[model samples]
Target: MIGNGCWFEFDEVRGKIIIDGPMTTDLSFAAEEMQKYVRRAHGMFLPIQRGVLSESTQNAIVVRIMAERLATVEEDGFAITYRNGNVFIEGNGIRSVLYGTYRFLELYAGMRWLTPDHEVIYEPTDRKVWIEERHDRPDFRRRGIILEGVQSASYAIGVIDWMSKNGCDLLMMTIEFWDEHQAALRPEMQARQLRLGLGGHSLDRFLSPGDYFEVHPEWFAWYEGGRVAAQPCFSNQEGIAFLIGRIVDYCRQEPDMDTLSLFPNDNKYFCQCPSCSTQSFVSNYTTFLETVRDQLEADGQSVRIQMLAYNAQIEWTMLESMPEAASLDVMVACWGRDYRQTIGSPAGDRDERFRRIVADWGQACSQRYHSSLSVYEYYADYWMMTSLFPPLARTICKDIEEYRSMGVQEMICLLLPYEKSVRIMQEEIMGLPRENNLADREFNSETPVMWLNLYMFARKLWNSSLDEAGLIDEYCRAAFGQHGDTGKTLLYALEQQLAQLTVYNTRWFKLRYTDVWIRDHRSKGKAVVTGVSPWAKEEDEPEIPAERSEVSRRIVEELEDVWHKAAHQGAHSDESTLLYQALTQYFRYVIQKLRSIDKQSSAQSKLIRQETEEAMSDLTEALQIETEIRGWDALHFAHRLRDPNVL
Candidate 1:
C-alpha cells in the first residue's frame, strides 16, 4: 500500500510502461533496468512504449525528464513518487531519472546490489509496494573511486554503470584506452559521468628542455647546479603565463572536465632564485592561481583549478593575502601515517606530525584563501595486497570524520597498483560440500580487506556519522550469513591482535605485510591462478619458523575448534571463515620456516611438515570456494613471498 492507502503491484496485471519525455539512450537504459526487476518480481517483463501513450493507459510507470535549465538536483539526484494510480520517476536530468529507477528498486523492491553482478532481491509474497515519495541526494558533490588500470577487468565487469547505480558520479583517467572501451558502456552511464586526470603532474612534461627550457632557462626551476624543466620557476612571470597557456590548451582538448589540476612536477626542485627567496611558496602559488582565475573568467569558463600541496611544498606561513578569485582546491596527501592510531592521537606517535600538517593545511585552505580543500589518502597498500584483512576501519573512519570537520569536501582514496590489491590467494585442490542456502553477496575475495573497506568507504561518504559496530554488523551479515556474528568476532579479534604488532604501528602496514609475503613465495613454486573476470591482471606472495610454528600450531587448532562449533557451517562457507583459516595456514608455514632455521631434529621436522601439508590442503579448499564466487583471473604470476628491499 502506498501513502494513498492503495496497494501498488507491478506485475503483468499493470499497464505497459511509457516514456514521458525524449526517448534518449539513457531513458531507454532506465526503462530496461526497471523492466528486468519487474520481471523478477512477477515472472513477466513489462513492454515499454517510447511513443505517445494510449489515451486509456492506466497504472503504468512513467519516467519523466525535466528541462535542462531546471536541473537543480545536481547531476545524479532524483525523486520517486506514486500519483493518480501511476508510478512516476522524475529527475533534474535524464541521468537523475536513471538513478531514480535504481533507487526505486532499492527502497521499494528490497533489492541490494552487493556487487556489480551479485545481488539480493527479496521476492515479496504479496507483490505490493508502499512507497512514500522520496527525494535523495549525496552528502558530497565529488564521489568517486579510481580503478587505476584494469582496462580489461573494467570492460568485462561493467564497472562504470555499476558505479552510477551505486552513487558514484565521477570516473578517473582516460589515457588507458578510455575512448576505445567507452563504446561498451550503457547509455545511462555515458550521459552522467566525468573523468579526472591523475597525471596532473604534467608541468615538467610540457615545459621541458625539449619543449621550451632551451629557449628560456629562467622559466624552469633551479636546483643546486642549474635551471631545469623538472619543475617550473613559480616566481617567473613569463613562465607562469606560459604554463597557464598550456593548461588552457589541454582544457580545450578535454572540455568535458570540470576540475582542472594545475599540479607541478612531483619533485622537490623549487626555484631558489633571490626573487623566490624574498617571499613564500604559498604566496607564489597563489599568484599563479590568481592569473589562471583571471584568464579563465575572461574566457567565460567556470572550470576550477586544483593543486597538490604535497611534502615540502606545503609549508604554512601566513599568506600575504588570499587570491581575489579562490579557484583552487588542494588535494592534501597523507603519507606514512600510523594505521593503528588516529591522527594526532597517541600523543607522541609518529602520526602527530601528519595530524598537525593536515590541520594547518586545512586552515590555510579555508581561512587563508577562497580555495576549497580535498584529501588524497592511500587507502590500500602493499600490506593490503595479501588476503589478511587490515584492521583499519576505526582509524579510517576517524580520518573521514576529521577531514569533514576540517572543511574538506572530497577524498581521493588511492589504492596501490593492480598486482598488489586486485588478486586473491589460491589454497585450492578441493571444494567443500554445503547443506543449505548460502548468504548471497558479491565481493572480491582476492582483495577482501579492500573490498570490505570499499563498501564502508562508500557508506562513510554518504553519512560520516557512522555507527562503527552497526556498519560492521550489516557488512558481516551481507558478506557472510547466519555465522556473520561469529565471523565478525574473529575479524575484530584479528585486528585487535595485530594492532599490538610493532609492524603495524604506522599506516605503512603495507611494508610489513610485504615483508611476510615475499618470504613465503619461494616455498610455493608457482601459483596456478585462474577463475576471475577475464580482465584481472597476473598478481603477486610471503612466510614464518618451527619454534614460531608453536603459535601457528595453536592457531590452527583453535580455528579447527571454531569450525566445528560454528553454527550453520553446513549452510555456507563464509569469506571471513576462509580468511581466518588462511591466516592460520600461513602462520603454520611460518613455524616450519623457524624450525628449519633452528636446525630441528629430522623427526620433529617430519611432524611439522605433515601439519604444513594438512594446512595447505585446507587452504586449497577455501581458495577454490573463493575463486568460484569472485571470478576474474586473466593472467599468471609468481607467488614470491620474499623481498628484502621492502624492509
Candidate 2:
C-alpha cells in the first residue's frame, strides 16, 4: 500500500482535483465512470490510487476525516480519502465530483445525510421475495395545524420546523380562540410568518350565544346532558348555505388552503332536537359536505371537508350514504381506542374496533368514490406509553398493514403532547419493519441501553436488516464519546432505567378515560365502585370510596424516593438542572402528603412520613446546591456556546 502511493500524481485544474491512478482509462472505464458517483457522494474529490488498495491507507484516511468530518460513505464508485493535511477524491474522472460532494456532507456538522452505505447488512434469503419499492408520500399537500390559545406562533413555527425536518410536505395553520382579546393570541401568525394558508375559528365570541341562538334557535342541538349545543344546521338552509359559502370564500381567499376541515374530531356531541333528531345525523353531515363541495367545484377551485368519527357519529355508513364523491375528503377520526380495550375484556375478540373501522373505510374509499379518505390518529392522551402505546401500536400496525394491503395509500397521525413520543414514534415503532412485528415485543427499559433499543427499532423504518451491535457501538460513541468505562456505565444505567420504566409496576396508573376516575376513587384515602358513574349520579359526586391499596402506596413511596434521589444528584450535573427542578416540585407535594397522612393514621404512618421527609429534605438540599453551582457569568458562557455561527 505504501509503495503504490507514488504511482499517481494530483493536479488542480479548472476547479477540479484530478488524479492519475495506476490503471489506464482504456482498461477500467467502469472504475472511471464510478468516480461520478463518488463525486456525487462526497461533494468533492480526494483521489486514491488504482493499485494502492491497502487497508492501512484506507484506515489512515478514515481517521483523518473522522476527526472533523461532516458526512461519510463506505462503498465503491464514491470514495473520498481525507488525510491529515489534504483530501483525496478517488474515481476515474471529473464526472465523479457529485459523489465526492455527497461524501463531504455525510459527515456530522456539514450535513449528516442518509446514503446507500447506511445499509449495514443484507441477508439474501432463499425464499423468493418480490422486491417492489414503493415510496409512500403525503396526500394533504399542506399538513395543517390548529393552534389552540395556549400554543404561541413561535411554538407553532418550532413544530413546523420539526415537521419540515422530518417529512411534512406542507404546513398550514389556523387560529382558534375563546374570547375577544384572546383572539390576539395568534397575532404572530402574520402573512410574513406563515408561508402556507392560515385559518381562523371565530367561535371564541359565540360562547353562550344570547342573540345568535335566539334569532336562530333551529341551529342549536340538544346534547346528552340536556345542554344546548350549536351545530350549523343545514336544515336552516339560508344560515347553513351562508356558512358554507363563507368557508368556500375563505379557502379561495387563503393562499394555500386547498383543504378545509370543519368538524371537531372528538368534542362534538349529538344534536338531539326534533328537527335534527329525526334527520339522519349522516344526512345533515352530507348536506354540509355537499354544500361545500358544490360551491368549490362551481368556482373551478378544489377543496375537501373532513368529518369526524366521534360522539354519536362513529358509524362508517355515514360516508357510504353520501353520494357526491367528488365533493369532500373523508377523514375517519380514530381516538380513544386504547381506552376501549380496558373497558371490555382484553381477551374477548382482541378489540378489533380500530382495525375493523380502517378496513371498512378502506373498502368504502376504494369501492365507492373519487374523493379519497385518510386516517386521523390522535395520541391525545399523554400517558400513551404507560397505558396505550404497546397495545395501540400492536393494533395500529396490524390495522395500517391491513389498510396498506387493501390499497389505502394515505394516513396521518394527529398527535398531541408532542415531546419524546414524536421521536419514539419516528425512530422506534413506525420505523421498524412491518414483518418484524416490533410492536409485539415489549421494548427493554434499561435507560441508556434502551437508547440502543430505540435505535434498533428506528433502523427498521429506514432499512430492514441493520446490525444491532454496530448501531450500539456507533450510538454509544456519539452519545458518550468514543466508548470507554464511562460510556459503558452510562449505557448500562440508561438500559436499567428504561427497563424499569417499561415494567409498568410503578405506582402511577395509566390515566385514560375512566381510569382517571378509578385513580381518584382509589386514592381519596378510603372503597368505592370501580367504573364510570351511572347517568343519574352527579358528575362530581364521590360515589366511590377512597381506597388506596397498601401495595400501590408502597410503590408510590419507592418512586418518590427515586425522584428525590434524582433531584439531589441533579445538582452535580449540568444537564440535570431542569429535571431536578421538575422533580423537586413533584417530590415536595408528594412528601407533604406523606406527612399529612400520618396525622390521620397510626404509628406505621408516622415512620413512613419521617423517612419520606428525610428523602425530601435531602433532595431539596441537593437542588439548593445545584443553584449554588450557577454563577452570574453563566449567561456569558452560555451565550458563547449557544450561537453556532459565532463558534
Candidate 3:
C-alpha cells in the first residue's frame, strides 16, 4: 500500500472486487471483467463480493453506480479514486460503471483493446501496479457508428463489444433489417446502455407505394406528368396522415429505439405537383416532419425523429421557413466534401456549398431552433473509393473540433468491418454473387491504415484537443513494440504517398474530366452544361494521361523503398510480423494495380491485356495468402479490384 490509503495492487491476492451498488447485469458484467483481467494478468483470481465490505477487508476494489453523482458527472462519465483501503470505480450510470472498469484495467494493467478480437495486455516486469486517481468524460455527448454492409449477428455483437470498450454511445442501423438483427443485438446493446437508432432512407417503408399505390395512386408523387412511387405526395394531407400513422406504430413497437429517421428515399425524386412545386423539397420535408412530430406527441411517444439535410435538401435557402422541434435531430450528411481537406477548408465548389450548409444548420439549430444537430461523416466510405485508404487522421481531428465549435452534439461515421472473413448472404442485399463476390473478399492481413484512421476518429470524438502525433506514436509503440520508431517512420512515408495518390486519383480526375468537357464544348461553340447524361458517348471521355502513369510509378517506387527498409531495419514481434506481412501483401497488390493502370495508358493493346491478367493473378495470390493465414474466407468489400470491367 502506498500513501495513507491502500491502493489496489495487481498482485494483491487478498483483494476483493466489491459491488457496492445494486446487483445489476451491467455491474455484474463489470465485476466479472475485472476479475477475469486480474486473473489473466497476475495468475490470481480475485473474489467478487456483494454489498459493503467487512471492517477487516483491505485493498478491495469497489464498483458502484452512483446516480446521485449525476450532478457532478455526465451519464457516461466515470471516476477512479483511492479511499480508505479500497480503490473505488464509481460511475454516473450502469454503463459508465462498465466504462470505469475498462478504464481501470487499461490504466493500471496496461491493457489495450485495439480491435474486436485482438487485444494487447502488458504484464508489469516487477509484478507491481501503480494506481492514480482519474476522472474522465467524452467531449462529444454522442459518439456513434452507423452500421452499413454488416450482416452477421456475431460480427455485429463483436462491434458492439468493441464500441462499449472504446466509449461509443450509439449504434444505428437501417429500419429494413431491424427485425433481423434486433433479437440478437438488443440484449447486448441494453447491457452496455448503448442507444439503438433505426431508420435510414426509410420514408418509403412508412408509405411504401407497393402497399398503397394501386388503391391510392394520388398519394404518390407526380413526376414527368405521371404518378410515381418514388416519394409520397407531401401536398396530400391523407398521404401525410398515413405516413405519420405508420411512424407512430413503429415507435410504439420498438420502445427501445432511441431515434428514428424520416429521411426521403436515396434519390432526388420529389413531388413535382403544383402544390409541392410552390416550395422547395426541404420546406415540404419540414412540414411533413412537423406533422409527424405533432402526431407522435399526441400519442405520448418520446422517441426522437431524425431528419437528413442531404442532396436536394442541402441548400440552406430551402430551410428559410423551417420551424424547429426540441426532439428533432438534424443530421447533415457531408457526402460530397473532399476528405483530403478539413470541412472549414473548401477544396471546390461542392465542398464550399457543403460547408455553408453545415454552418447554416448549426446556426439555425443554435439560435432559432434549439434542436439537436449531428454530422453524418464518411471517413470510411468504401463504396465511393474502393480499396483506397486516405490519410485523414489530421483531418478527422480538425473536423471534430470544428463540429464541436459549431454546437454539434453528436458525430457518427460509417465504418467498414475489420473482420478477416465473413459469410456473404443473398445477392440482393450485398449486390455481389457468392461465387465471385468482391464484396466478400478476405483481407488476409490486418489493415493498419484503416484501423489507425478509425482509432484516431474515435479518440478525437472523445477529446478534440488530443495530440494526433502523440496518439500515433502511442499506438505504434503499443502495436510494434521496440521497433515502433521505424514503424512510425514507415507509416508517415506511406501516408505521404497515399495523400498524393488520393489527390491524383480523386480530385485530379474530377477536375480533368470537367476541364475536358468544358474545352470540348467551347471548341464546338456550344454552351457548357451541368448534369451531363450517363448515356454520353464513350469517345467523349478523356484518355489517361502519360503524366498520371508516371506519378503512379514514382509513388509505387517510394512505397516499395519504404516497405523494404521497414522489413529489414525494423525488428519484429509476433504482432509486428503480422502487421508487416499484411502490409507487404497489400503493397504488392497496390503495386500490381498501378502497373496495370500504367500499362493501360500504353499504345499497345497486348501490353494492357497482359498487365491486367497479371494484376488479377496478383490479387488472387494475395487472397489465397489471407485465407491461409486466417483459415477462412473473410468477407471484405473490394469491388474495384474484383470487377474486370473496371480494370
Candidate 4:
C-alpha cells in the first residue's frame, strides 16, 4: 500500500500514473514529466492523474511532500513515502525527474529492486528518506576555464553542472564586482554576464569600512578602540542600503541563483569604530542580514541567505544576537581555517578536528538560529599537487556522522577547481551502498576516480546514511565500464600514495635563517632556482653567515627530504604524467634548497642559474615527451609550465 503524503503512483492495469502532491511549481509538473521516465523505464506511454491541492489529498498519501533546504536560495521540494513500494526516486525538478527516472530504469534493468520470488522489495532505508532533492539548477554548468586563474561564476557553474549529474544538490558562487565585465549590467553584457554579481579581485574594490573613505564616509563603524580594514561599514546607512539593494536585485534577476551568499560575514574581527566595534560577531552578520532582509522584503520576493562562519569571527558569542529574521529563510555555510578532519592521519587528524569544530559550530549556531547548517569540508589542497580523494572522503564521512550526531542535517564539500577531483567524488557518492555501512568498501573505479568522488561528495547533501560499499561498486563499474581490475589497481595505488603524502604535505615548516638568506641574499631573491636565474651574474655576490642559520638549514633539509620522497613516489608510479609533474615540483624545491646554501658567489650563482634553466628545460621536454607517449595533450602539464618558478 503506497500510503500517502505526496506520491508518484502508477496503475499498470489502467496504463496510467498519477503524480500526487504538495509540490513546488516545478514538482507539480511531475506527472506531465513522467513520460520521459516511463519511456526509459517501461518503454511505453501512460496517462497520468494529479490530485488537487487540499488537506484530504495531503493527509492520506503514501508519499509526503517535504523541503530539503539547499546551500543555495532555490527551494528543492521533494516527495517522501513511509510505505514500501516497487520503486522510489527524487529529482531537482524536470531535469532531476528525468534523471531519477533513468536511475530507476537502470536499477530495473539490473533487477536491482526485484527479489528471487519476483516480488519487489523497494523500501528506502528510512521511510522518511525515500527521495532527497536539489535546491536549484546551475545556469551555465560549464564555465570554460579562465586563463588568469581567478575562480569565476562560469567556472564554478561548470563544476556545479558536472557535480549535479553525479548527485550534487547545490553549488555556491562567491560573487563580486569584477565579474560584471568592463561594462555595467548593460544589455550587451547581459548575455555574457553570469547570474550572480561578479567576484571582485582587488581588495580596494570591495566595500570595506576602511575603503569607504571618500563618499558616505560617516557610515563607517569606528567602534571599540581599534581600527582595521577588515570590517564593512554597516553603520553607513546609505552605503549599506546601496550594497544591499544590489544584492537583492541580483537575486531577483539571476535565474541560476537559489541562494545569495553574503561574503561580508567573512570579516574576522569586528570593526574598530568607536560606535560598534564591540558588537558581537554574529550581531555584525545579523545587522547585515537585517539590512538585506529589509531590501529583499521591499523587492517583494523572499530569497534564502547564506552567511559564512569565516575567520576570527567564528565564536559562540557572535551567534547570540543574530537577528530573528536572518535565522528564518536562511542557511549556514560554515568555513573557517579548514575542516581539520579533512586531512586525516597520525600527523594530521582531520577527522578529530572536524568532530570538534562541527560540534562546536553546530551547537553554537543552531542554538541561536532556526536554520539548516551544512559543513563544507575542504578536501583538496591546491598549494601543493595532490588529489583530495582520501581526505575529502574521510572528512565528508566524519562530517556526516558528526552532523548527524549534533542533530544538524546537511553536509557540503568545498571543492577546489579540479575536474579529476570532481569525478572521483561522484563515484564515492553513487558508490555509497543501499544503507549506512561505514565498513563497506569505498567507491573505486578502473578508469579515472574523479567522477566517483564527485558522485559520493554530492550524495552527502542528500542522505548520509546510504549504503557505502554497494554505491562504491556501482560507481566503480560506471567509471571503469570494462577495465574493473585495472581501475581498482590504479585507485588503490593512488589512495596509498595520497595517504603517505598527506603526512609529509601537512608538515609545516618554520622559516630558518637559511630560508631567509636564500630568499633575500642568495640566488637574487628567488626561492626557486628558476626565479633566481634571471638576475644571475659572474662577478657580483651577496654575503651570508652560514653557521648562524642552523634553523634555516634544518628547515631546508627536512623540506628537501619530503620533496625527495614525493619524487620517488612519482617515479615508482606507472602513470608517467603524474610522475613527471610530481618530479618536476620536487626538483624545483630541491634546487631552491641548494641555492639557499650558496648566498655569496656570482660564479656559484651563475652555475646554479644555469643548472636551474637546464632543469626547467628538461621539465618542459618531459611534459612534451609524456604528451607524445600518450598521444594526447598534456592537460596537467600545460598549466605547470606557465610559470616554472612562481605559479
- Whole-model lDDT, candidate 2? 0.36
RMSD of each: 10.2, 16.3, 6.4, 13.3
Cα misplacement distance, residue 104 of candidate 2 (Å)? 10
The positional error of residue 183 in candidate 4, measured at the CA in angstroms, is 17
Q: Best candidate per lDDT, number?
A: 3
Writing each residue's lDDT as its tens digit, candidate 1 over 168-205 gives 56555433334445445423345554344334455654
TM-score-based ranking: 3, 1, 4, 2
Stretches of candidate 3 exceeding 4 Å from the true structure: 1-6, 24-26, 122-127, 312-327, 417-432, 436-446, 499-540, 543-551, 571-577, 601-647
Score residue 315 of candidate 2 by CA lDDT.
Answer: 35
Ranking by lDDT: 3, 1, 4, 2
Model 1 TM-score, 2 decimals: 0.70
Error of 3 at 80 (Å): 1.2
Candidate 4 Cα lDDT to native:
0.39
TM-score, prediction 3? 0.82
Clashes of each: 34, 58, 5, 65
Local error of candidate 4 at residue 332 (angstroms): 6.8
Q: How many Å off is the CA of 624 in candidate 4?
A: 9.2
CA displacement after TM-score superposition, residue 294 of candidate 2 (Å): 1.7
With candidate 3 superimposed using the best TM-score fit, by how many Å does residue 288's alpha carbon deviate from the native? 1.8
lDDT of candidate 3 over 1-647, digit per residue (tens): 11333345554667789988665544777888889877776667788889976777777888987747745468788888786667888887768888888877877776766667656774343335456776778888888888776768887798788888877888888886678888889889887888888888788788878899999988988988999898888999888888888889988888888887777776556789999999777778877887787788889888777777765423334333344443367887765466667788867776677777778788888877778888987676443333435546677777888888877888888765433123322243234445534443423222556656667877888777888888787777666566678767766765666544443323432222111111123223333222222111232323333455566668778877777777777433355545544554555555554454343333122223446666555445534544443312122212324676644
